[model samples]
Target: MMNDEQKTDKKQRLIRKGKKVQEPVNTQLVVNIFEGFTKDERDLTQAHMGAEYFRVMAWIKEEDEQETIGVRSFRGFHQFNERLVFPLDCSSYKYIYIELIKVHSRRDPATSKGTVVMGRAKIRLPPWTSRGKFTSKFNLVGLNSDRCVEIKGYLNLSMQLHRYLER
Candidate 1:
């Protein structure tokens, strides 16, 4: 009969042979939100009357249990060049949801205090792209689905997936 040591060695060999080897993956997702512009200057100006600042929130759509990937605040109505970074794990989630909120200086009678959602945009990860670097532009909308913002606004964004180290 084989000794305990011999049995252990055989078990170890079988375990090693059965286990599938995988390389370590280290990747980062970088997002740059560059600019915001509006054609309806009058409407844009009116909207900014009680606006204190703007806040941007990001999260993964799949595992959205009130958890956020990142949050940023900019103190202006225009020209916000914000940068956000997160770990890149495509298998964990499929899409990233970005929301832009307008923080008012004072509470309006019509609405409650604090921040109000002005618009939102979604970034869909392409399955074919390996490099994972791209630029996109989106239009901002209002609360009412049919009643879009009278202002014709554009939001510029750039997203990249960079590989850092591998083992």
Candidate 2:
């Protein structure tokens, strides 16, 4: 027979022994899109007209989940100064897909009224960068019928990653 304090101590020790120690988790990714440019060129000449606005869609696709992290809309052709942040487990995601769509409001019912994809880009985490802070340039491309067309617009993006111990 043991006293109450001894019994408590014994239970604590057992619990501590049975508990599995967890290592510090440091896996976090942050992305920032500062600005983009649509140059004045032959391919982008048609895009300038009837272009009400442009939007960016960012998402991460995983084996069991597909998540959209950010969507930003701007009403200009020269610059899209935007900021987006995502708190996600980077290891589980397969790839990050980004699409820049040009929007127009057309009264004609025969045409697709609202949104048209102007550019698309995909990034795989490991090979891109490890420093977690950098700027990248991506060319805008569009699809015409069964062919891919390169537009004269480009997107400038800045990305950062932060890792801290999880509580």
For this target, which candidate reaches the highest TM-score against the unseen true structure? 1
Off by over 4 Å in 2: 1-26, 38-51, 62-76, 90-94, 107-113, 126-129
Q: 82-110, model 1: which lDDT tens digit per residue?
A: 77776766556567787666555343435
Which lDDT tens digits does candidate 2 get at residues 47-161?
A: 4344345567776643322223223434434455666555555466655677775555342224576665666777655432366577788776665545757564677877666
- The alpha-carbon deviation from the true structure for residue 126 of candidate 1, after best TM-score superposition, in angstroms, is 4.2
Total clashing residue pairs per candidate? 0, 0
* Model 1: residue 69 alpha-carbon error in angstroms: 15
Residue 33 deviation, candidate 2, in Å?
A: 1.2
